[model samples]
Target: MLLFDFMFSETLNASLVQSSLVCLATFSAIIWWLRPSRSRSLPPGPRGWPILGYLPNIKFSEWCNGYQTHDVMCKLAEKYGAVFGLKIGSKDVLVLNDYESIKEAFHHTNMNDRPENAMIKNIDNLGTGILFSCGDKWKEIRKFTITKLKSFGIGKRSFAENITIEAECLNSEIAKIQGNPFYSRPLLEPATLNVISSILLGQRFSYDDEELHFILDNLHRNGKVVGSGGALLFVPSLQIFLKDKIKEYRHNLDVVLKYFRGIVSKHQEEFDPYIEKDYIDAYISEMRHNKDKGKQSYLDVSNLVMTLGNLFAAGSFTTSETLSWAILYLTKHPEIQKRAQEEIDNVLNQNQPRLEDKPSLPYTWAVVLETMRLATVGPLGVTHAVADDTRMFGCEIPKGTMIMPNLWNVHHDPALWSEPNEFKPERFLNENGQVEEPPQLIPFGTGRRSCPGEQLGKMELFIFITHLLQKFNFKEAEGESPLTLEGSLGLTWSPTPYHVCAHSRE
Candidate 1:
């Protein structure tokens, strides 16, 4: 009887211990779920799920609901104010929604670094390019690239002749369609690419060049893939599940890189320091000079390849896409197109548009500015990072925090633009009937890290738009659905594929 009593006591003790442990676990979980998510130092934002944070929300909204990443961010900003915080995976993301916030944050020296995320690191393993590199390397390469490109007539009036030549080529391509409805990207992209190519590769590719077509095809495809799969960069653990997408992204990037590598190799073989033919030749000369000095420098073969890749990708894609958006908008709004053409006609008198004629054509320039504002191609801009723990706009941003400048928000902000959704070129004009670009019109971003190609891009826009409008009238295709201004987000916010009838103005 005593032994039986002891056995019962032991069984009861075990049950009590097990029950206590279960309760403790349940209580702990509740505390974790209900914990104060907002750090006193951080900006206000949603209290997302434990561990995963706001990543799932972003993915679901983008994948399931067809919302663009920028659209999702704008919605969050509506609730959280201009400065919002989010914990994306293991990183802290601070999104600057207003022009003030973006301007201050981008100009801050400490806030100038690029995110050293897995995906970014994978793109240029050496981290040698101007777009993604930080610190001295970026500064050195950027300065050199800018100086060299200028010498090659990138931003100067001398380059206007080359652009005019390319514009003529594009005009011929469009004229081939003979007023039939056609997609503009195929013609526009190559024309823009050739302009940049003259500076970078020192030669132009014929429209039917097999190699150029292959590179362009891959580059365009990768832009879309990056938009859809870019979240993987923020939450790398998800890569395991989305291996196929990651693989495709890598493959596309690899194909482009392979072509660039061959070009770089050919340049190296034919490199002559005394005679600099193009940007590549100038870079090789610099590399050799550094070598001759026995100096440890970032100007090496790897850096050159990656820098060229960055230049080629950025130099062509954004400008071409912006032009595509311009054409789409003009096609949809024929009145705007006619007015712009009239302004061009009045200014140029049937002559090819020149860079110097920009000031003389206020309405046409306004049209370009308006298109840039409405389209907001790089909607999210480039993701920035804090080099150290810093305070920005009354929030304590942690070191290595990911900074997202929601260019879309700033462009579409009701406070900044009247009827922000509508296309109004006059918004860019003042009472004086001259072009007036407000400080808020930051289509290529602003501050130190703004696009180096800004001037060149503007030059391209002015030259191409004026020339195109001078020679042709763009309108919606007959028997086709109206083109929507709503753009699909990729590496850029590009117009949906639509056919435009380009009738000869002559």
Candidate 2:
């Protein structure tokens, strides 16, 4: 016991010494690197510790409670203007706060790649998927995703029909609640997942499917956990100590991977190689057709699994969470809900809401837009990296610098909006009663790396919200606390747990 204790103590002490030395080296490098170099033209921002950087100023509890990382950047931007930098650990992240700066920088080839994170590297399929990849691999997969998704008719009537079918299932599931207060998270999650799953897996799960619900529940639970724990992704030394947290994240994604793998294996056994039925079959068909090209081709079994699953996982959470926020906001301010419903009534008038009705139902669409801006899901909208050394806003952005577009800042900047903090849908409507999409209202982002799933997400959000509002009036359930705008920031900005009483408008 004494020998074991001695060895353990020695190991612990050595780790501490290593950490301390790293700290010292980090500071020494910063001090030497920042020593009045006229050639260095980095942006103006906060000065952090040697290795620790600005992480000391970021409070995890703040993000957990309501304040998000993007919100932190916004406050810092108040002092540092729209284009500023934050040294996080050993990395320098250039934060773009305004629409103009972000728009300008995002399209620059030198500023349009993705960052490498230990956390994502560990979760990603050998860093082979779209969300955290770079170079030719990223280009190939991205082009493939865009082309395949479009070929599958992403924004067509058949696609809307898929979403509409899910809406019918969602309504039936909500009706099962029998007008009692229900947690809308579970009810809404499946509807969104089902639509995306159909494209990726060629099938959808029933609402009661245990594995389906497990993926959904963990997505909500782990998005916040992984997002909160994301600091460790940048801070390497701390990651080893936080093994359990990393493992949990791995395990959550593995569950999703496991589900996808099973589906792939089933398809593999039945893969006809010549026929393409869905996204999976299409890829498999391509792989079989291109086997002679060998490694020259990016098509493979692993990419097939991770790419499709990543697409599936990415689609489910944020869209559903945004809808949840919309419900919460509309319920908290019944006046907004009433106005939205009246618009629906005026246009559809008991007829089922259709995508064609979108133009006519400007108020309802405006309310949804307001929710996305106020809630600001995926605030940072994934970290970007510079493709090459570039200059922006009169500052030098070297190659490999992390670029973060603070969409939350753009949405909430007082100078950009009439009342940034207020939830007013009228801000989106013009004197002509047509919905005006503000240039600054960039929820989906822009440029080559912008979200490819934007159109599909918008379709699902519109169909789901219009249908739900048309059928039911959402109110705070009895014995529940008043709905709060305070949300938990995970993969997306999500509302804290709240229940709603659904009254059938019929």
TM-score of each: 0.90, 0.89
In candidate 2, what residue range of length 10 has the lowest lDDT sum?
1-10
Report, for every candidate in turn, its global Cα lDDT versus the true structure.
Answer: 0.80, 0.76
Off by over 4 Å in 1: 1-40, 62-66, 120-127
Name model 2 segments beyond 4 Å from true.
Answer: 1-40, 60-66, 120-127, 217-222, 234-238, 292-295
Q: How accurate is candidate 2 locally (lDDT)?
A: 0.76
Model 2 pairs in collision: 110-387
Q: 462 in model 2: Cα distance from truth in Å?
A: 0.5
Instruction: Give the winner by lDDT.
Output: 1
**How accurate locally is residue 239 in candidate 1, as Cα lDDT from 0 to 100?**
54
Candidate 1, 193: how far from true, in Å? 1.2
